[model samples]
Target chain A: MSLLKVENLQAKIEDNQILKGLNLEVNPGEVHAIMGPNGSGKSTLASVIAGREDYEINGGRILFEGEDITDLEVHERAQKGIFLAFQYPVEIPGVSNANFMKSSVNAIREARGEEPLSAKDFLARMREKSALVEIDKSFMSRAVNEGFSGGEKKRNEIFQLAMLEPKLALLDETDSGLDIDALKIVSQGVNTLRNENNAFVLITHYQRLLNYIVPDFVHVLADGKIVKSGGKELALELEEKGYDWVKDHAIEEQTA
Target chain B: MTDFNEDKLIEEVTTSDYKYGFTTDIEQEFAPKGLNEDIVRFISAKKEEPEFMLEWRLKAYRHWLTMKDPMWAKVDFPKIDYQDVYYYAAPKKKPQLDSLDEVDPELLKTFEKLGISIDEQKRLTGVAVDIVVDSVSVKTTFQKQLKEMGVIFCPMSEAVKEHPELVKQYLGSVVPTTDNFYAALNSAVFSDGSFCYIPKGVRCPMELSTYFRMNAALTGQFERTLIIADEGSYVSYLEGCTAPMRDENQLHAAVVEIVAHKDAEVKYSTVQNWYPGDKNGKGGVYNFVTKRGLCEGENSKISWTQVETGSSITWKYPSCVLKGDNSIGEFYSVAVTNNFQQADTGSKMTHIGKNTRSRIISKGISAGRSENSYRGLVNITKNAKNARNFSECDSLLIGDKCGAHTFPYIEIGNSSSVVEHEATTSKVSEDILFYCSQRGMDEAQAMELIINGYAKEVLNKLPMEFAVEAQKLLAISLEGSVG
Candidate 1:
């Protein structure tokens, strides 16, 4: 069964139709890269999949684990093993990173009818995950993303993703402002966490992040629709030819 | 995602009922429903106070009549009719008991329902609690243990009778009878409160706490608390209160005064959970309180920490007077106003001695259609050379209709004195809520986490037991406040 499937999903924010008749499917153990130009509904697709409330679902449906979940709340989707690494992570002052992760982990545990982790075990897990992302021990005690640089925020998001251990993780422009070193660190964290039982959807405008964590499938999104799909080499082609080449070909095919 | 209706969520949040709203059905007595010279005399006689005390009450009552209710607070309410309210009410049955077993079963049940089992508190925690209900002190636990350490801890009425000299000496020393409108009223009609005095060079062995409750209808509660720490002594005190829900607004005016002598340190903490009005602001307690402390000798210290999450309209300012050179004064507060509640509370630090230092940290949270404000004053006199003061007031608004305000007044008289003030106002933005929700926290859980984090600085100042209870109160007070 597919881990996530969206069939002719139409979504909009207010009067602006951001996702019109978009369709995609992701089976378990497969990484999907969503490469699109600006305003091509890349981020909106990721947000809608994560159950963001701002967008209105006008038609169609979303299924997760072969179960319809179009009406689930954002937290409900999260508790059911869906994670979104925010494009611009919000800063929550006075809440420590460790505390935030603890709450998240416990909420998921409760949703699964499992006992909460003890303080000692939670700390041990936090230490292990922080090590995976190269996040300093000091960051665990500091407020969540509160005085962090762009790179640090991205790293923190990846650290959270590792801690959550969701079945399907969506990275929305997670590589936008990261330096080469930071990007490598973030990708390394994702690579360490990936397994056959879980999958990732990497949303990026450039193919630079794809070089580190190679995707099995690269899909081009244009004007709220997936225009093309191919192997990982498609990313390389788009990188060399620029997004305009794909857009021109898609328009020509539509007219023909 | 399932869409949340903002209107429905707000209605649900605002109508969250008070948990401790049940009234106690015990036989009670009332001083005829009115306030006058006769009522003052009646309350004084009921407590069996001395002549000096009666004279003081009469003086305060006379002064209160001359003064009008101050209307400068940022709150709206109907004018209080002093003539229609009961000035005093207490349980008709009074028993002199040395143990909790001898207390009235009905009163015991009331306390148990409030989650404060005296027996459990006695066995698990070494806190000495002086329980007062309806302006009357019912029982005081651990009196023998406290007395052995040269600590005089008892009810104010008991102190007036047993330790008359001490009471007469320092009763109104810090907060005078003419301090304010409420303070004067409290002095004139106050019935029962906690009284503590730590002897010179003796450190209190355990925390002293007082639990107050209002059980009668149409009654105004006025209590007086006085604490004096002698030279080189230290003491920490805790206070908590609640009231039954009612349709007719009740008045609560309290006066608390503290005095710290040379090298003594006093820590006072309060978790006030009075019954707030209903969703439409129909009925609740009007809390008007006067609390002040005096650092009388060199190197003395006084700190006030309060978590205020109750009352429909609150007008309070816990202040400290730095009269001793090298003295220190600290104030930490977390005031939450939800539904139709309005709170205008903060602290005042007055520097009078050389090298005195003071710090103020106030956090105000407003939800529903409430208003929360932090109004503080920091003053350094000319003699306070090299004095320093730092004040930070932050306000958090949960919804668009609610309001948060900060008014900081600073007066520096010496060039050497340094004073700094910082203020910020922020909303519980939808983005922040979405971030938490996406991390698997529901609306209530997310609000609790954010609020606890925002007020951590103030909450940390409370003692262990009070800190836990305060956190729970904060959570309950803001439940369903956000969509």
Candidate 2:
């Protein structure tokens, strides 16, 4: 059985339809990459699945371990092991990174009917995780994402992902503004958090990130639907031949 | 399996009650409801003030008769009838207590409910508390320790007798009898408040604090607070206030004056949580306060920090006059208004000496149809060469029905002065809320964290005990007002 499944998904923003008849399924331990051009509804699918209010789900069924979760709130989904690494993380002044992560972790624990971790336990965990991401201990006292460089911000997102230990992770353009070193760090963090019982949906505009965190399957999303599904070679093929080839082939297949 | 009522959920998520509303049942000394020259004389006579002090009170009374009420604040309220309230109401307990042991049990219980027990607070928080019930000071703890360091901390009535020369010299120096309407009224009929005098070259041993409790109905509390830091001395003072719930509105008009002599520093903090009116705007306290400090000597400094979260209508401007060369002044404030409350508060920094500096930071949060504003003024005199001033005011609106405004007045007479003023108004974005909730925090916790973060700059200025209480109060003040 699939760990996550979407059947006949249709979504809209205002009156304009963005996702029409979208379908996908991912079993446990699978890593899938959704590659598409700008305005091809890739981000829309990620946001709708994460329960953002901007996109209206006209018709869809989202099943997480065969349990329908189409109406869950963003935080509810988060508590149920869904994580979205935002494309542009927000800067919250005076909220320290350590404090925010601790609170987030405790909140998730509370939702799962567990007691809050003591301060000593929480700090010990933070020190361990900080070393994993190479984040300076002093960064824990500074405001969250405030005055952080772009690379640092992306790394902070992964730091949170590691802290929450979500079962299904969505990386939305996480490599948009990262340098080579930052991209390596972020992908390494993702690779570290992946396990046999969890899945990942990497949404991106380029094939460079796939080189760092190798994906098992690549789906070409065009206009609202997945036009083609293939193995890792498809990403290299699309990168070399451009999206026009995929679009023309998809149109030909539809006509034929 | 469950149905959600959006409106009810929103209401439940936003409504917060006053935490320190517990009242103690105790007998009280009461004065007749009215205002007159006899009432002033009666209060002075009750304190057994010297003939010279009585003469001063009579002079202030005569001047107050000719004064008119000032209505420049943006707050709207019914005109206060000075004749319809009692000018003096104190607990009918003993006038003198030999020690904290002899103090009345009811009064002690009241202080405990307000989180300021005489013995425990002194030992745990290192705060010297002077508990003022209604219009008179009940007891002042830690006077012996403070006196060992040549610090004079007592009630205003006692200060008149013990430190007569100091009171005579500094009284009405910063704010005169003819300053304003409320000041004039306070001058004539002020019952009691805290007075502190730190001797030269000495720092206060502990934080000097005063807790004011209004426990009587239809009473007007006029408190006069004066603090003087002699040359090379330093002191930190904290004040907290609360009131019992009553159907009739109470009046609290206070005057706090501070003097920082040459090279001296004075830091004053206030956590004001008086009863704000209920949802329909029926009953609460009307707080009209005049607080100012004078940096009279060269290199002197004065700082004012306040967290105001209560009152039906608050009209206050804690100001500073930097008259000494190279002196400094600072004001940090966080004012939160909910329900039908209204607040018009900020600060004024007047630069009169060369090389003086001043900084003002004001944060106002408005919710539940409340109106909050920051009105400030910064003036540089012609002789103030190379003076510097910076002002920042930010307002946060929780709901569409509320409003926030900033009115800053900047007047520069010195050509060499540098002054900057910035103001911004913002609402809690849905995106920020969603971000927090996505991290598994409920809406209430998310709102609290965000609000705490917004208020961190000013909240850090408060003393430790008061800072924690103020943080909790900030969260409670925003309850039932956010969704």
Candidate 3:
């Protein structure tokens, strides 16, 4: 069974129709890279899959672990192994990232019929995982994403991802605000967390992120539909040619 | 159908009768159902107070007649009918008891339901408890243990009877009878409250706590509390209160005064959970209180911490007077209003001595069409050379319909004084809630985590027992705020 399957997904935010009959599927141990220009609904698709209420899913179904998850709430989707790393990480004042993660991890564990992790064990795991993104212990003690630099925010997201260890992780434009060094660190953290039982979906405007964490497949989205799909070479081809050709081809295909 | 059939169209609102809403049925004694000199005299005579105290009550009542009910506060309520309310009501069958077992079992059960079994508190925790129901204190636990350490802990009535000289010396020293409208009223009619005196250089061996409750119908509750810490002594006190749910709003006007002498320190905490009306804001407690402390000698310290989560309308400001050179005053508060509750609560710091320092941290959480306001004042006089003060007031709104406001008054007299104030108003962000939810917490859990984090500073100031109860009260008060 596929880890995640979006069948003709259609969604909108407010009065704006963003996702129109988008379809995609990811099996275990696979990395799918979604490349699109601005406003092509890349982030919308990621949010819809994560069950963000900001976008209204008007049609179609989302299946996770071979179970229909379209009707699930955001927290339910997350507990069922769907994670969306926000493009703009939210800064919550007065809530330390450590305390936030403790509640979250225990909640997910509780949802999975498992006992909560003891404070000693949880702190031990957190210390170990902080190294995944090279985050300082002090950063974990601070408010979630508060006063962090752009690089630190991205690294913190990846660190949270490492801690939660979701079966399906969605990175929404994860490489947009990062420098080369930070990008390498974030990508390394993502790579370390990947395994045969889990999958990843990376959404980006530029194909540069595909270099560090190489994708098995690349899908080009335009006008809310997948215009083209190919192997890793497709990303290099699009990077070389720009999106105009893909837009023209998509128009041609639509007209035909 | 066009006759405005209000009752037929909608059901009446009954403010949440919380866990402490259980009422014990007992024979009642009552003073006249009105505020007058005679009622004040009746209260004074019933308590068997001395001539000086009776004279003081008469003075306060006469002054109260010339004053008007304060309306400048941010809270709003219907006009209070002073003539309709009984000035005093006490359980006629109860008498002073030396041991907990002698108290009425029904009264004991009421306290038990409120999560405070004085017996359990006595056995498990070292905290001394003074339990006051309606107009009297029935029992005080750990009196013997405290007496050995030269610490006097008893009801105000008992203290006036047993230690008249001490009570006479310090009763109205911090908060005078003419302090405010409510303070004057409390001065005239306050039936019973806690009284404590820490002897010179003695650190109190255990925490002192008081639980005040209002039970009799149509009776306004007025309580007076006084604590005096002698030279080089230290004491920590905690107070908690609740009332039964009713369709008619009940009145609560209390006066609390503290005096700290040379090198003394006093820490006072309150977790006020009066009944906040139902979802439609029909009925709840009207809490108007005057609380103040005086640091009378050099190097003295006074700190006030409060968690107010109930009351239909709350108008209170716990303040400190820094009279001693090198004294310190700190105010920490977390006020929450939900379901048509309105709270205007904060603290005041008056610096009069050289090198005095004070700090204020307040958090206000509003939900369910309620209004929560933080009103504070800081004054540094000319003599307060090198005085320093820092004030931070933060407001958190849960629903879009709720409101939060901050009003801070700062007055600095000399150039050497330094004062800083910072405030932030924010609606509980949907993104933060979503972030927590996506991490697997439900809405209520996420809301509590965020609210607690926002209130961490003020909550940390409460002792362990009160801290736990305050957190739970905050969670309960904010129910139905989020989906």
Candidate 4:
């Protein structure tokens, strides 16, 4: 069974149609890399699937575990084990990262009809996850993302992903501003969290991330549609030939 | 099932009921519904005050008649008819109670419902609670223990009879009768409040607290509180208030004064949760209060911290007079307004002596159709050489319909004084809410987390128990505020 399925999804933000009849499928344990140019509807697909209210679904449906979830609220999707590593993590002053993660973890657990985690267990989990992401223990007590450098904020995002342990995760431009060492650490965190019961969708403009965490499949997104899809070799081809041929090939196929 | 219709949800949540809106049914006594010299005499006579106190009350009453209501605050309300309010009301069958067992069961149940169990506070928190209901002191717990530490903690009415010399010396000494209209009215007809006096070189063993509740209908609650920390002594005091739901707006005018002598420190904290009327503002309490502290001798310090989350209309400025050389003063406040509530509250710091210093931090939050304002004054007097003052005022608006304003007045008379002020206004952005929601928090929970964080500085100044209560009040005050 598929972990997620999007069929002919159409979405728009205020009058601009960003995702026009986009379709994709992710099976359990699969890693899918979405490569696209600027304004190519890659982020829009991730947002629409995560149920962001800013985007209006013009047509089509989203299914999670064979259940229609197109009209669910953002937090509802989150409670059902969907997580989005924000491109720009927000800075909430005076709210410690540990406190924020605790609230998030408990909220998800509550939705699953589980008792809240005890202080001992919660602190232990935080310690383990901070170690996994190579974040300093001091960062746990500081304000969430406040005064954090670009690399630190990206690492915090991965730390949160490990804490939540969502069933399906979407990394939206997570590697955009990361330095080489920070990127390696982030990729290692993701690799450690990947399992057969969950899936990952990595959206990026650069194929450098694929070198560290190789994908099972690669899809080229252009002008609000998946222009081409293939195995891992397609990512290397696109990396070698800079996305121009993919558009020309897509146009040729359309005209043919 | 978790789909949130933003508008509908806000509508449903904003009109949610006030949790502390229930009234206590007890036998009560009342003086006539009017404000006059005779009524002032009536209140004083009921308390059996001394001749000097009666003369003071009459003088204040005469002065009040010549004064007019101050309309400078940024609030709107119907005109108050002095003749329509009951000047005095108290529970009948009041004899000197020996213990909590002697108190009426109904009154105990009322305190229980308010979650301020006097017994629990006495046993666990070691707080001496002096509870005032309907403008009369019901009980003062832990009085004996406090007395062993040379602390004079009792009801104001009792202090007049037992400690007349101290009362006569300090009453109206910090805040004069001519301070303002409400202060004058409170001086003339104030019924009951707490009084604390720490002897020289003694530190109070327990936190002194007062809980004020308005129970009777059509009655105005006027309470006066006075604290005098003697030279080299220390004390921490807490005040909390609430009222029942009513269709007619009730009035509460209070006066609080503190005097800290050489090397002494006094910390006063208030968590005011008065009833703030219905969604349309049909009924609520009009809170007009005057509170000031005096740093009387060198090295003295005084701090005022308040969390205000109730009342339909609030006009208060808890201020400090840094009179002693090398004295220090601090004021921290968090005022929240929702529905049709209006609050204009802040602090006033007057640096008088040489080398004095003061600091002010004010946070205001407005939601629904309410208006919240921070009005503060920092004055560096001409002779206050090398005096310094720092003030920070921040406002947060929840919905588009609400308003937040900052009115800061700074006056520097000497080149040696250094004064600094910072102000900022912000709205709860949709992006922040979206981020929290994406982390599995619903709109309401996310709002709570963000608002608490914004007011964490001021809330942290409160005592541990009061900090918890203030956090809950912030969440309750902001329900259905975000759209």
What is the C-alpha lDDT profile of model 3 across B136-200, one tens digit per residue? 98877888989999999999998988999998899889999998999999999899999999999
> Which residue runs does candidate 2 get wrong by more than 4 Å?
A118-120, A240-256, B1-14, B95-104, B481-483
Q: Please tell me which model should have the higher TM-score, number 1 or number 3.
A: 1
lDDT of each: 0.91, 0.87, 0.88, 0.90
The TM-score obtained by model 4 is 0.98
* Model 2 residue A79 lDDT score: 89
Every prediction: chain A TM-score? 0.98, 0.97, 0.98, 0.99
RMSD of 3: 4.3
- lDDT (Cα, tens digit) per residue for candidate 1, span B190-257: 98998999999999989999998989988899999999999999999999988888888989999999
lDDT of 2 by residue, B52-132 (tens): 888888888889889877888888888877789899887777646567777777777777777676778767877788888
Give the TM-scores of the predictions, in the order they appear. Answer: 0.98, 0.93, 0.95, 0.98
Error of 1 at A237 (Å): 0.4
Go through the candidates in order and give each one's DockQ.
Answer: 0.71, 0.41, 0.42, 0.58
Please, what are the lDDT tens digits per residue for candidate 4 over residues B128-231?
Answer: 88899887888887888888888999999999999999999999999998889999999999998989999999988777899999998888999999999999
For all candidates in order, state the fraction of native interface contacts they contain.
0.71, 0.45, 0.55, 0.51
Instruction: List per-model TM-scores for chain B.
Output: 0.98, 0.96, 0.95, 0.97
For candidate 3, the docking band is acceptable
Better of 3 and 4 by lDDT: 4
The docking category that best describes candidate 2 is acceptable
